[model samples]
Target: METLEAADMTQLLMESHELSTMINQSREVSDYLSAKRQMEADVEAQRLLALFEKKKEQYEDVQRFGKYHPDYNHISKEVRELKRTIELLDSVQAFKRAEDSLDELLYQVSRTIANAVSGTIKVPSNNPFLEAQSSGCGTGGSCGCSVKKPS
Candidate 1:
């Protein structure tokens, strides 16, 4: 009986030691998981911050120079080429006209404004063209509508 009791105590002690070791290992695993999660969150935050910075820079550039806007790329390119051509030209008036390049811009702006006035944003008054009963410059006056005058 004494030998059996000794053997039982030894077995219990071994089991207790194993249980404590498992508990310690579980704690370590928990710590490791927590660290990994925090690292992932930190990496995600940094990624978002970088994305925000890039977008902010683009926004600032667009605000500072209107040509940087996404919608202005093609028009801006055309304008730049036009300016270069005008610079090469020997005539000053031609250069001025190219530099102004106001026709297309004016048309687009006017069309957008007209659409807004007619649909989304209401204006106090209608456009003169809308009020006019006849088309084709009825008064025989220079009613500039998509005119491309040569300088």
Candidate 2:
């Protein structure tokens, strides 16, 4: 019985590796990689991203002091504006869309695998909308559909 279990585990590992390779070769991944490369190669986008990161760090520092900090409002506004500017870049927008697409595809694959193992198995997702919709807990588990602990 132990030997059979070991064989099954090895087979499962090999199959998972194949699945990973297939996913890596998928169009979603290809688009994501292309968009990422474009974003990285854009000089303006890189500059804006660096500025955004610096402003975001400043915002985090001021956040701890709340509104009482002298630079809080300025830092907050700067971060927001920088973020908006970054988002407006074509390369940044394309990268974000491709990333989201790839994320959704991976999420679907995870959900399929989990459901195959057991229908009750809940698959965690990066997208909040997917988590709520896929888990049948549309109301965020307030309707008594929450997972129960085994007694």
Candidate 3:
């Protein structure tokens, strides 16, 4: 039985490796890698990214000490503006789209595998009641009570 289990594990590992290779060779992943390289080569983007990181560290340090500063808000806004500027670049946009596509694909694949293994897991859908419950309103006298039933 132990030998059989080991063999099964080995086979699973081999299949997983092949799947990873296929995903790496996919067009979305290739585009993402190319865009990442382009972004790395961009001087202005790097400068803005460095500034954002520095500001983020400062904001986090203030938060860690349980103190709020106007500078934190200012830094946050500046970081957001810098992010928007960086996102406007064609390479950055392409990278973001490609990354999102790959993320969505991976999510679906994991969900499918989990469903198969667990016999249709009760995953949440976009139902209003479920949404209300997930949004922390399941109590009888809470906002969930205001949700009208489907006629």
Candidate 4:
């Protein structure tokens, strides 16, 4: 029985790796990679991103001292403006959309795997919509909720 269980575990791991390979070859991953490459190759994007990071650091430092900081509002505005400018870049926009698409695909895969194990199993995701559903004590019996355990 132990040997059979071990064999099953090995098979499951192999199949999971195959699934991973398939995911890596997916259109979402391809688009993500292409967008990332384009974003990296964009000289303007790189320059703006660097500037954005510098402004963000300044903003963080000012934020640490709260409203009392002399340059708080100015630095904050600069950061926001830089973020807006970065977002407006075509390469940045494409990369962001591709990233979100890949994230959604991974989230769906995780949810499917978790659901196969148990409907109540929580599937973590960066999506705000999915997060709203998982907000409470996840119905997994371990949470000490009034929800009944799956049979």
What are the TM-scores, per candidate, against the unseen true structure? Answer: 0.19, 0.85, 0.66, 0.83
Clashes of each: 0, 0, 0, 0
Error in Å for residue 24 of model 2 = 0.8
Models ranked on TM-score: 2, 4, 3, 1
Q: 2 or 3, which is superior by TM-score?
A: 2
> What 10-residue stretch in candidate 3 is worst by lDDT?
130-139
C-alpha lDDT values of all predictions: 0.46, 0.85, 0.65, 0.84
Best by lDDT: 2
Instruction: Supply candidate 4's per-residue lDDT for 17.
Output: 99
Candidate 4 lDDT tens digits, 10-80? 88899999999999999999999999999999999999999988888899899999889999989988888
| Model 3: per-residue Cα lDDT over 1-98, one tens digit each | 35533348888899989988987888778877887898888888788788878877876776664436657666667767877887887767877787
Off by over 4 Å in 3: 1-7, 64-70, 119-151
Model 3 clash pairs are none
- Candidate 2 vs 4: which has more lDDT: 2
lDDT of 2 by residue, 36-133 (tens): 99999999999988888888889999999999999999998888888888999999999999999999999889988877776567778778877766
Query: Whole-model lDDT, candidate 2?
Result: 0.85
Q: Is candidate 2 or candidate 3 better by lDDT?
A: 2
